[model samples]
Target: MLKRVFQALSGARPGEQLPVLLSFMALLCLLLSYYLVKPLRDSMFLSYYQASDLAYMAIVVTVSSLVVIKFFNHWVGRIPRYRLMSITYAVMMICKLLFLLILPISGRWGTVVFYLWASVYFTLVLSILWGVINTIFSARQAERSFGFVALGATLGNISGAKLSAWLAGSAFKDWALLLSIGAMSAALGLILLAVQIASRDPETARKQSGTAALHVSRGMQDIVSLFGNGYVRGIALMVFTLALISMAVQFQAYGQIDRNTAATVYGEEFAWFDPPGQHFEVIYGLKKLDAAAQQARLKALGRSGNLPTAQIQELSQSFGRYQKQFESRTRKVLSDVYAYQGLLGVFLLVVVARFLFRFVGLRYTVLILPAFYALAAMVLMFPLEIALIQVLLVIGGALNYSLNNATKELLYTPTSEAVRFQLKPLIEGPVMRLGDVTASLLQIGISTALALWLALTEMSQGRLLLALGLLFIAAWMLAIWATGRRYDQAQQADPPRQELDLHA
Candidate 1:
């Protein structure tokens, strides 16, 4: 049954089954660790900071990512592949252990540090894993097998998200970090075993030797030369534009959450009541009351100005209790969003991705995400209910994780080893973060301008953001077309091997 299922989903012959299965399991654990930590990281940060603060945090993360990836590239030649992977996992585990100890006492700063580290962690770890996989499989093998292997990641994401939500609501919440660490340890073991199995194949062994021999230059120079290639430039543009649009959408979603929550707790008129620097201060002075009392107080404040200090103090005490409830609610909502997103991803990877790859072809498959983004932009043109925003987030996230991700990884299959190890990390890590920084700066600027404009007119920031995102999507689509053309050219130049026989 297992063999038949593997063959049906992946087109893997008997000889190809073991390596694919091992690779699948390794990726499963890798993503399991990542998803487990993701909610915790977001919840912890948002507990003390506003949603807008993430833009600045993204800047710090981008800078840190550059340093981390540069160091990683330097060691690509010095360390053996499997051993290097193991060491990276070990270091991450140790950092998680430190976070476990430090988070409790270090306050908001600790959360900031973890957030930055987690961003870098996911980028670096994913690049390394895919780099290893690219080394193991021939281009033909990767085309058919990558989707099936990626299924493990989808399952792991679902399991991790569900597990994190359960833990957050249960008495075992404290154990979540430890479990994430254990998941990475398991992944490290599986990765080492997979590398060992692939090394036994003579063709794979020869490929690995050739890859190792090509790593003669300093990693920095190789990265510089990679930009000279038009295909690489196209990929970087696509990645950057995707990151920019994603961050903009995320900021809008978070803003909606904040606005909705404030409306519920404060009053309906307070729904659009976004004060520049006085968000918490305003919340502190306003008591949670019925519509009549809230409206009465709003009128009173408008006429009489500031409340008495004693009254403000009393209301702030009440707001503190409300803040705890707010934090708990925020965590639960984020957990649900991530869980549903992962579930959708699982469905797409299992049912949609393979068919698209088989029938749609690479050029068109690359167009799907931008097309979806265009639809999402249309949705943002109207006032969005919280539930609708959550749906958008889940669907958008699902598409990226499933169809988009599988397609992107396959693009790397035809590249050389130096490109895979050195240049790929730089593109995926720092270049991606550079997109986030650009988005942040844009958000900050637009928001500052809008805060003044909103006083006179009733325009939403989402519409403006959508307009900007549509432009980015256009560029993204063009990049995909160019990159797809290059990829097709590469594949034609050195065609894939014949499909393996099932009975062999």
Candidate 2:
């Protein structure tokens, strides 16, 4: 029964089952670790900074991603695939451990650093994992198996988010980081096991080790040359557009969450207090303030004269509780949102993705994301409640992780090893971040212009985003259609050549 289920889900042959299952479990652990810390990262960052600050942080992330990708590209051919994976995992573990130790003392600065690190970690590590999987499985196998493999990641996402929510709400929230570290360790072990199994097969062995013999240029020239391949350019465009859409949507969703949390904790008139100003310190530092000090600070800030002394005392006493409540609530909201996304992802990957891949074919499968984005944008054009926005986020995230992700990874199966290791990372890492940067700049520009000209708030920028999203969706659709044609042509030209040996 187990074998039948695996075969049905992944189309894995008898000999391929072990590697496929191992890869599944490996990815499960990888994503579990990530999702475990994701809620904490978002909550902590939002606690210290405004939702708008995400755009500035995105710029930092994109720059750091470029540097990291360049560094990783430099060693792609110089290091063995397995050793590189091991080393990357080890380094990440060390960094995460360090982050855990210093997070308490680091304050907002530590939150910023961790947010940036986690962003880079997700893209870089996942890129490497997919690259390794590409080498292990042939293109044909990948189409059938990748969705099933992604099911593990979907499950991990659900498990991690749910666990994080529970832990955050409980007294054991402090242990979440340690658990994430342990998940990473488990992922490393599973990845090594998968690689060892794949090494037993001659074709897989050659594919895995073939990059070592190729010459990799030590400069930007190699990366630049990748653009000469129209397919690579198409993939890059798709990724860029997708990232832009994702980020824009995320910005709106996060803004809503921030507003909702503030309203819930401090009431709808909380904005009048201007918590980002000196009152921020007063509110957060309430624990250290006695009633007299609190009244003094509020009086100095011209905020206490309107309220009665009893109400003032009550508010001051509850201010510390409200701060904690805000953080806790934010964490729970994030975790719940992610958990819903993961659940939807699992359902789509298990029930929808395979059917689509098997029947709809790769070309059309690539079109689903843009269509969904277009629909989502249309829905967001109207003023909706926070629940509606969360629904959109959950759907968008689910589609991206399940159908979109599997299809995107499958696109690289026919590419060369250099493309997988070097060019692919450039596309998935820095290029995607570039898309994020684009979205951020656009949002900043729109918000600034609206504030200056029409005296509109940031929340009013959704109409412009809807228009921009349509434009991007059109470009995304075109890129997918063009890239799909290229993919089909490449497959026909060399059906047996799973990994095209394009010497860099």
Residue 236, model 2, lDDT: 87
The TM-score of predicted model 1 comes to 0.86
CA deviation > 4 Å runs, candidate 1: 209-223, 261-281, 284-321, 449-460, 492-494, 497-504
Candidate 1 residue lDDT tens string, 260-321: 65445544223233334245445633433433564556455544545575654444444455
TM-score each candidate. 0.86, 0.90
Q: Residue 316 CA error for candidate 1 (Å)?
A: 6.9
> Considering every candidate listed, which one attains the maximal lDDT?
2
Give each prediction's root-mean-square deviation over alpha carbons.
Answer: 6.5, 4.2
The pairs that clash in candidate 1 are none
lDDT of each: 0.75, 0.80
In model 1, state the lDDT of residue 444: 75
Model 2 C-alpha lDDT versus the unseen true structure: 0.80
